[model samples]
Target: MHLIELSIAKFEENLCRLKASETVCSSSFSSISQKLTRLQDLHECVENFLLLPLTQQALAQECGDKWINELLDGSLRLLDVCGIIKDALLQTKECTHELQSIMRRRRGGDMSFISEVRKYLTSRKDVKKAMNNALKVRESNCTDKNHETPAVVNMLKELDAVTIAVFESLLSFIAGSKSKSSSWAFVSKLVQPKRIACKGEEVANTNELEKVDAALQSLVSHKSKKSDNTIQVEDVQIWLQDLEANIQDIEEGLECLLRRLIKTRVSLLNIFSH
Candidate 1:
């Protein structure tokens, strides 16, 4: 029991640190990727905590409780969200790769570039829609403030909430800005005389994903202009490569966390089955 308490305390401390970090540096590709890595570490700790003999005994005693059922349901939902994000990442990567290939080949001229750019934009919209649907799900709260829950149950509830919160952040990052403001509107800010005069450093700090988005919007809007003139094809390609690399890193982290989640779920099932 003492060891179990220590484990729970350590997990809570780490969770608090992650939440604090989120507030300070909410949404950059590097920050999101780092968050994913930290999440993977936290889930591994959870899996170890669940494997403790004391934890198994306690959970077994509470086998038929509502909280146990809630945990099981929450695990399934987490898995579902993981699957959706992984698929979205993969689709985006493939689309980006196709665009890069088209740019390199420059085979069919402006029409080909325009067709592929449109396809990539359409892909982004589809991914955003899927992420939004995933976000709409209201998770079951097993932690009741009015009713006193057991320590193990409370710890698990907090863990579930934190895990879901991290996933929500990741999903939102992938979905990009939801504001109706046009990508053109954003690009204009970059090139407008006032912005060009005053915003040198700030513009450089924008993420590769947004940079590519704005460049693509410019290309599509000015189809008659030479693509290189509208937005250097070379610059867009570099941004796409950077985006691809970051997405790949996130995907690897997600895969590891998904495995850890599965292990934790299986451990819970075994406890309840006994």
Candidate 2:
């Protein structure tokens, strides 16, 4: 995902440079074409990652003992790459607009090129929304109840670290820019605490397994009361199965979220290159 994002940014940079120039050269076209090819390959890789099975047996066999930590690390890298790609895409849109304005001032340049750029921009926006939603879902589901397993907690902590790194990078990137003071300052304030809070939650959850167990027991007991003693036994059994299934689902969801984030980053790279 990082590779894809970097390629995309390079592509966009080239695009902007080419647009700014009075003449379009063969080398410029070749660069854009190569970036486009790489973007497509990166998209395929993301799709393959998503299609991978998330079962413990599969993960163990494929990634061994370091699966969880490695997955988390990869996810974080992808998030950072995607974030940068998204920013690049936004900048690309502005560059395209400037190019359009320049073309409009020229004698015979076609204005329809602006419409094509708008179409790509719209697609990029949709991808960004999807990535944001995926992240939100992952954050929402990473709770004590759903992620009580030690492995999951550890993985989440690693993810949190990655998130913090990405957030800090973004803060630095924005701070270094000459944008409006209030806007960048506000973004910095908003992101810093969020990164801290996310990391804090992971730490809290790691040591709160006993509490999670207690809550699970309470939920089971409360639900068991809805039926007679004899029926409650059967219900309890069914409930336990359901609970396990829910846990598994949550685990799978986490994996899916990670994959989606990777894909999002790759897509962003594609947009940047375009």
Candidate 3:
């Protein structure tokens, strides 16, 4: 039997098993059975087309074209599934934020409520896996090598942007609201000053370092003058550290992307040159 026919048979068998289960209601089982029957009808239609003579080249081509279209539709559906998973992750982040707000408002600071939210966060592993699997399916569908299509490249870039946006939004939300100092404090450590090279030579200007220090000091002095309730000096230091670290990471990622783009452009030029 053809692959579609086999799949239809398996679906029908599963539907039968589901219907036989004592736990399932009659109405639900009937609905599923009807859907399976429709799928079986589709399978029969495809089987009829396949049974036609090889001399009917146009009909064979039409069947092949329809099959390819169905494959593309399935792949697009996988992409939509990934989007749904991403939205679910965002909802989880929102729930975490709301829980944090509730904790802050409550006098006793209920630990159990926060714990429940953390548990929900932990349950996101399956959703993450589903998203990754969908991404893999989408990537596998793009087999063209000679011509680089905008759709393929844009899809990848959009996926990357969504991921980065989600992470950054979650981090910012947690940092701003959560009272659990450990979480934000750990992130602060990630933002610590590291030796970075701008040009070929190492930065040796004591004056430039002094200028940066002076600017930070001036900002602190201004804030202290303006507001009676200012953030703690330690917190300010940590925030600055984290900001620097994030800037470094962004710069590195940009450089890597630029290099890849340049390489692809060079390859394309060589292809045209030939």
Best by lDDT: 1
List where candidate 3 sits over 4 angstroms from the true fold.
Answer: 1-75, 107-109, 133-139, 145-274
Off by over 4 Å in 1: 107-109, 140-147, 180-182, 189-207, 223-230
TM-score-wise, the better of 1 and 3 is 1
How much is the lDDT of residue 136 in candidate 2?
40
RMSD value for candidate 3: 22.2
1-274 per-residue lDDT for model 3 (tens digits)? 2543454354445434433442333222123223333333333333333333431232233334443343334334433443454354354444434544544554222455435434434443444444454444443233332233233222223223333333233223222222334333333332233422231123221112122223233332342333433333343344334334433433343334334333333432332233
Overall lDDT per candidate, in order of appearance: 0.78, 0.37, 0.35
Q: Cα deviation of 148 in candidate 2 (Å)?
A: 29
lDDT of 2: 0.37
Task: State which candidate has the highest TM-score.
Answer: 1
| Clash pairs (backbone) in predicted model 3 | none
Clashes of each: 0, 1, 0
lDDT accuracy of residue 18 in candidate 2: 30
- Ranked by lDDT, top first: 1, 2, 3
